[model samples]
Target chain A: MLDSRVLRVFREVFDDEQLAVSDTTSARDVPDWDSLAQVKLVIALEQEFDVRFSTTEIGTWACVGDLKRALRSKLGAA
Target chain B: MSAPAEIRVSLDWGGGEPMIVRWLVADRAPVKRGQAICEIEASKATADIVSPADGILVVVIPDGDVRDQEVVGHIHAVGEALPLSAAAVERGPEPDVEGGTHVPRSLRKAAEIRTLEEGRRGSLPSTVMQQLVVGDLVDRLRDGGASLTALVILAVARALRKHRAFNASASDTGVLLHDAVRIGVALDVEPHGLRVPIVTDADTKTVAEIAGDLQILLYKYMTKTLEPDEIRGATFTLTDLSSFGVAWSVPLLVGRQAAILGLGMIRGADPRDTMLTFSLTFDHRVASGREAALFLSDVRKRISEHMVSNDSGA
Candidate 1:
């Protein structure tokens, strides 16, 4: 299950106010999600979740569901 | 009706991954005479597409469509029938308009200077002229609350009046008082390479009118159509790097021009977290270094006042 807080972070980062976390959402599905915007999103996620993402780990996140899984593991480890 | 020009919105990543359109500006929107049309992620760097003309943006791609390369968008060309595809949209070798080219900086600067000279010859093509006119107007409006090109020119005249040194020129007959002063505005070819196109007798126009003229002038530089009278008569010059993140630059004096002013990028700490740095250079013989510094200080004061007044109005 996706953490509601993490989903909220996504909505705020993309400024969609209407985004939902689902299994198929990738970078392309978001309009304002450019590379620079992605950097900002990552920064926000780290601060909100109190987790550090490795460059390799960040690269592994291709979809919202994928990012959720990574966040879960990081939160569990912490 | 005849066929509208077919503009494709490309999305494929060559390997079949659809690319997303991260639009910076709106569709079918009339873009700033010189601003980027949109930003696209290419293989090497983020590419900012520019508008070739000012017109209603006819949006072909509705923002979220994912496609391959060669996708066309609505063009500025106005006609009953759209232009037939004569060339691939994204296939041209990128003009050295953005990324700093591998060409030596000195060489690049020289080329840009030459290009400016060409623009002064009144040979600047029509397209460039339009862009320069519009861009300059937009810039003035952004800096000042209301942009009547004439009013802006008058303000410049007032600013020059305050600086007596720029008002005088040197010849074999010692120094002479001139009725007018020329001001050159620097245009960035690639948001990096700089070119100066003079606005003839800029001191005479009102600030508002100058704003309108400056927009036309920027278009001339971009389209390569500046007239000789416009580019050749400047007595002083102003270079603005504020749009880019440039902190400052110390420039060499152009021939016969008494002074050159460089406006650095504006930044500051919160309230808003940005800062600004400034540089000014002038002919040591005509205006002492100290005097030049005073002129900058005065201009800074004026700009600060302008900014404050604008904020209040908004």
Candidate 2:
């Protein structure tokens, strides 16, 4: 299951209460998930998960599943 | 007064095809010196031809294709009548094209706007893209109740002050550098294409001041109340596509301006700071690739340093 905090962060970053994200959800799935919005999303995610991402990792994630896996790895490492 | 000064379409310094003439002022209209009388459109550039002397406008050619040094119209002194030989008076009205595909007025207007860029597409620009780390700047602005767009404008203006060559126009003599740093902020007017409102004398203003001006200009544009002056006189332009999730875009040059800067989406792994790509497309005729790179570097340095200074003060 996707972390409730991560889902909450997405909703907050997009400023949409109805936004739903699954493991397979990609940037194309969200209308407001643009470049500027993506930056806000990263900041929100860091605050929620208490994890930092590298530039290489930031550029590689393709969907929510990739993000979830990365988050899981970061948490495990911690 | 002396004979009316003939207004001619001068050949574009960066020579290309002849320009299409469209008069802004009508025949027999009283005009002031330096008033924008007509707009000349070539494939690469659209220039507003202004009146040289205060007088009455007498259009020799109401609307048609005109070549270099060809007399398009004249600015006559008061009491001077339209010459009988003036073709505008002779021609009753523009006839509708028969058997021609009927184009919507909106479509024709859109085509008119694209002609200038389409013409110059043949001469490809030298573009340089660099990823700027602007996390600290963005955070500082958010803390100070300032706008990120305004910060970018100030940075660009600062860089332009040092490198005037990037803020220049192509002239018959050479590249004519502008003394004033007017930065055009590209606003998507939506369904109507883009409308760029120029922030005049940006180099002289603070970030807060520039933000205030942009707020007023953007509101005017949204309300359809923007004046002609607000939309003209830009030496450089900035288009931020971050909101649209665009990572990078090669922005097109407006008019005869030397360069355009595009702000892409900001991304970062770390929450405290992020990286955004700044794409600059410049006229190779006015500046070389090295000069363009240096200008971007200067902008990046200025923004970084300014934000740091502001943070320490707070």
- The per-candidate TM-score of the B chain, in the order shown, comes to 0.48, 0.65
Tens-digit lDDT track for model 2 on B150-248? 878998998998989888876445788988888988887454456788898878888867766776666566556676567766788899886567889
lDDT scores for all predictions?
A: 0.52, 0.73
Tens-digit lDDT string for candidate 1 (B121-145): 3221111000001223223343342
Give, for candidate 1 chain B, the lowest lDDT window spanning 10 residues. Answer: B124-133
Task: Point to the candidate with the largest lDDT.
Answer: 2
Off by over 4 Å in 2: A1-78, B1-115, B118-124, B189-192, B312-314
Indicate which candidate wins on TM-score. 2
Rate residue A22 of model 1 by lDDT: 72
lDDT of 1 at B288: 66
Each candidate's number of clashing pairs is 62, 3
Compute the TM-score of each model's chain A versus the native chain A and list the values.
0.82, 0.91
